[model samples]
Target: MKLSTVFYFTILFIFISSASYSQAILQKNISLDVNRQRLENVLEILSNKGDFYFSYNSSIVKKDSLVSFRASNKTVKEILTELFNNTYEFRESGNYIIIRKAPIRMTLVTQKGITEEKIYSVSGFVYDEQSGAAISEASIYEKKMLASALTNEDGFFKIKLKSSKTSTAELTVSKEFYEDTTIKIQPRFDQQLSITMMPVEIPENNTVIKPEDYLAPDSLQVPTDTTEQQLPVSNDSIKVQQTGVGRFLLSGKQKVQSLNLKNFFTTRPFQISLVPGVSTHGQLNSQVINNFSLNIFGGYTAGTNGFEIGGLFNIDQKDVKYFQAAGLFNSVGGEVKGFQVAGINNLVQDNVYGFQAAGINNFVTGKMHGFQAAGIYNHVSDSVKGFQVAGIGNFSKEKASGVQIAGVSNISNREMNGVQIAGVVNYAKKLKGLQIGLINIADTSAGYSIGLINIIIKGYHKLSFSANEVENVNAAFKTGNSKLYSILRAGVNLSDSNKVYSFGYGLGSELSLNKKKTLSINPELSCQYLYLGSWDYLNLLNRFDLNFNIKLGKYISLFGGPSYSVYVTDQDVAFGGYRFPVPPSHYNTTKFSHKVTEIQP
Candidate 1:
């Protein structure tokens, strides 16, 4: 009876203990599933905040309880603590806690301890619109602050910021000749932002003048008392009238009054009048002066007809057939020829030739070719070739080839073959002969040579030297056996006594500097060999020259120079006697030298 009773108790105890063990395992599994679900949900929320990864041991549980809870601030620590806390009621042999259903309070505590922590960063690129290409050297500025950065060659940029919650940032980029752009970014993991920029335009400079009205052709009806009257203009014929004695019409269209013409004179009209202002033959019928010319104060004209003195042309189509002047006054135009002298001014013109002279004045119109002189200045136009000399200055155009010399200056175009020398300056385009002592000369092939302090000779295969030094030479030839190539040399220094032979086969580059009117540093380098043979040494040398110079002016410079050279020679030499240090037959050496040379320009 005792043995049976003991067996029954033992069986009952075993059943209860086994049931408890199974229950603990089942509860722990369920608690683990709950914690896992909570962690996955929290992770999903945190992932939205930043990018991260997570891991933990599933076999571990919280405390001795089948369902225990572990809690901590860090994700890795929080996972371990939640397991231990949930299994505290069912401690196991393994490092893991036994699975158990923990109190709701403990589970809540674990979840709270495992709160997510996040960090955020931002980055991006900028580009050009039309080219679809990356824009380099663009400046990017943080809108809120003065801090800025330039984009790299690839147009990429990056920036860092700290954020506890979500935030927005603004960026501005700018470049020369390009419109600026702005961008807004939301804080997240790594974000990409790209932008494009456009371009800008430019504008020109001048003045435009418009005509207001026109004068009618028969409007000027002279009174019967008028001694010389101009007929009413028809479409084909324009009238001319002269009111004062010795009064004549010079070239160039003009409109003036008596106050403007105090001292003036007039001579006969030349065959062709090259008026400075525009003269429309069609406008003569309408009597409307649609054309306007400014900057004409006073002048004179003289030719084969009788001379007219002291007169001005106030209106169009006036003729001064025969007259001379010794007083102050004004009048206008036609057929005045002779030796007419005005105390201060004159205006003359006709079909043959006209001469006008005035004090500190101006003359404009057709060829007053024969003996047209001005006290201060004169200008002759039209196709008149004759002698025009001015006391102060003279300017002529349209084949005015005679000795058109001026006291102060002279400027002419076309074939000026004669010795048309100005006291101070002279300029002509096509010259048949010579130009001497001229400061600046620009003549075509017709001129034999130009002699001056400085000369620029431009041509193919030309050689130029200054006194004893060879300045420049360009020589080219075709070697039929091989190929054809040309040699160009510029800024070379060669003397008669110390000859410099420079043979440049390929491309050549040279740089020079001057100081105190002398060449300071003249460094020249060529792809091939450059030779310099002097009275002292015959050097068969290869030169790699680097020169720096300080130039004082066109004629003087000081230079400090260095050259890398490869010396090729068939001979070898020994040094330091017994040591017998023989340099290689072919060796490289670097030389440093300083030189000062005077350059003639």
Candidate 2:
């Protein structure tokens, strides 16, 4: 029983053990081969062309290195199929991959530097009107306070500004006796603009005077005497007499007394009459009287006479006659062959032949002839005369003859043949020349002339001159304030007789003192072109200005400043930037400086 059974069992046990060992060895070999194949695939993917970012789990891995990976399956089925008979297992987390080879690293680099900014500039001009003159020393600035420039003698200006902000720039211009101007500037890289300025109002020089009168009486009464033997007298008396009849009537405390006599003449050729508070006369020739009162005063004469009164009023004269009076008011005298007189307030004179006079609180009787004299508080005795005078508190006696003078408080006593004088207190009698007062007149063989404050005339000509210059650089030259003409002129020009032209250039600087006030400085250059006959002339000018302006109110301001100017003229010079041939040159240049203060009202 033992030998055969033992040998068989031992052989069977040995075969079983051998088969198990062989299986274990085959499984290990499969796993190694799968790992190797995976590593090769990962390496191939890493070494592919084109740039890419390399990433891994928390641990960094070198690029361009072989890596290993396996399918996420428990069985070795996929590993054997993909990696040639192998059995392996692997787990992946985020970007991590199980690999057999170490990784390689790579880096990149870059470079850097700096650049510059660019700047730009602009230029333009301004000009004047009326004489076609070049307005030098004109102010030029950016309307928005962004930039500014001024015109030179040729009304030219240059400005430097940032090119990037070109769209924001605007040009502004200002000059004396001309309104301000502004132009929109679209500076094309660097550009030049031409502009013009128009003339402004030219103020006149004049004076006005007003006078007062107090010697005016509320009423006046005059009485006359007549004989009842040769003339019939009735309650309402109406008398008809010849041309040469003298009558006197006396009444006792009468409420109403009037004389209706037409065509009555004085007997004496030259007579003098004096009365109380009032006096009445008709047709007196060549007579001199003083301190007389007239009620419904009337006169007609062919010669000369002088009548003076305190508050004489209402006198009428016709035909050629001359009369003089003083200190009269509210009277009328006119239509005399020689002269008539009425003086003071409400005094009117008309149609006089020779001369008439009137005074304060008095009026002219009638039309004046040669001349009429009246004073303030008085009026001319007549009209249509050579002259009339009426001063304050004074009136005319009859009518003025040669010259009429009217002033404050004037007086007239004797009959003046040359001129009449009326002032606050003045006198004239056959005067040849001198005249004085706030307003006075003197007339002889020479022409008549009137003056205020002072008057000195040479021959028949009078010379008057006025100058005004404003330098405002700091003020904003708003485009809203510029006119069309000012926007187009930018240079200086000159011309003769029939034709004219001008050009100008300027520069200006302004510092804002406040939102509304500013300090300004301006420099100007201008060149003028003139054509006389076939010749052309060129003039150069330069000016500088400095000013401070204060805004007093919305539409008003107080401005004051100083200025310096220069001008030159050349006979042989040519202009640039023009395609025309060089023309004949005649130039002029001048320099001046001054300080001024003004109140803009």
Candidate 3:
């Protein structure tokens, strides 16, 4: 077949698929069996059963909580109203349904010749371009107005605003991992727009494009391996039996093992009990460890090598390998080698080698080698070698490698060797990577710093004071170290009456003639503005100087050099007001006091 025919057939197939999806009617009854579960989960069940989709924010909707209810047969609208208790509002757009916060109640009084506030409702549905599935929790915001809304469980939104006479604004739709789209809205009246967004195509493996191949000429590009490998999102709990993800579970295993405290003796490879007190340790359970453990409420084991799950908390006295999950907290004394998920916090005294997720904090006193995400803070005393995300701050006392993303600050006391992104400040000593925040500081920077204030304490800085033939008592604040530096200088003719201001940038290098005597050479180019009332002119000077330093003490040095200067200025100083190598005949003994070759000594 021809390529044009293939393209036409593909378009037709997609259109038919989307049309059928939109035309799917909700005829099946929504059978509910919720048991105090989260509203988001309940909505998901309803959408799946009724052949629709739910769009909601993960932040606003909790999906992990258990719910309780049982209904054999019920309509979708009735079930949702009872589930939400009339708190959230719902809007329907074809097969999609939108959930939103209810607005304040208002009465409609439509009459002739009555100037009342005209309220207009903007409704729409956001969908995926390829799959045509509803994209839940997509941001729909006005570009020029302060009105915005998030699409509900079915990717539907209804934003009601007071109508204006010339109310035309730009509407922007954005979603995570998707390309953003924008449309103009002329909302003098009520309007509905169904927006389809294309997902962004990111290469799976690391791929890079050079800047010079994309940017303008006259600029050099230093290309590095910028394809950062992002770690996978940390799982909340360990998977069971390494099964395929996303399969619906009608019911899970519910087994209990509990015996009297006197029935057991030595440590067991696996222990299952109603609580930790009646485990294999019997009455002497304080020092016993287990390879695999499970507790209905909470557990206190000496150590764990395999998986362990608890309802409230899991306290391991020594070390914990493999997966360990708890409802409240998980604490380990020695080290954690695998994944650990907790509701409140995960604390390890020695080190953690795998992934860890916590509701509040993840603390490792020794070191951390893998991914970690916490609600408040992630603190590692020794070092961190992988990715870490924190709600508030990320602190590493020693060296840190890989990526760190924090809400407030990312601080490393010693060396840091990766990307650091934070809200306020990112500081490190001897940073060998990139730092992006409001303020970035490094003691010694061998990498890039991008922020408002990029302070490199040991990089390039100096101050020098010198005297030249044209200007006496010249003081310059030379920035950048001895190897390469720039200068901003000012001088005055204290011996005469010619006040001059010089400002310029310079490039220079410093080399060691020997270990005992350090010598430097500098080539400086400057523009000087000579002021003579309103009669002012400009001076451009190019000079190269070799400076030899003789150290007297740690804080003092003596330096001098031989200078070759080429002066160019639009001034009435030479013969015919413009001349190089001024005529010796034009010079009187008293008139030409400061000649061009006066520096020849």
Root-mean-square deviation of candidate 2? 53.8
Poorest lDDT segment (10 consecutive residues) of candidate 3: 253-262
Cα lDDT for residue 163, candidate 1: 41
Q: What would the per-residue lDDT of candidate 2 be over residues 301-349, giving only the tens digit for each residue?
A: 2223333222333222222233444334322222334334444333333
lDDT of each residue in 217-278, candidate 1, tens digit only: 21222222223323223231122223233235432122121111111222212212123122
Q: For candidate 1, what is the TM-score?
A: 0.27
Local error of candidate 1 at 204, Å? 38
Clashing residue pairs in all predictions, respectively, total 101, 208, 15
- In angstroms, the error of model 3 at 36 is 82
Q: Best by lDDT, which number? A: 3
Model 3 error, position 424 (Å) = 1.4
lDDT of each: 0.38, 0.34, 0.63
Order candidates by lDDT, high to low: 3, 1, 2
Full-model lDDT, candidate 1 = 0.38
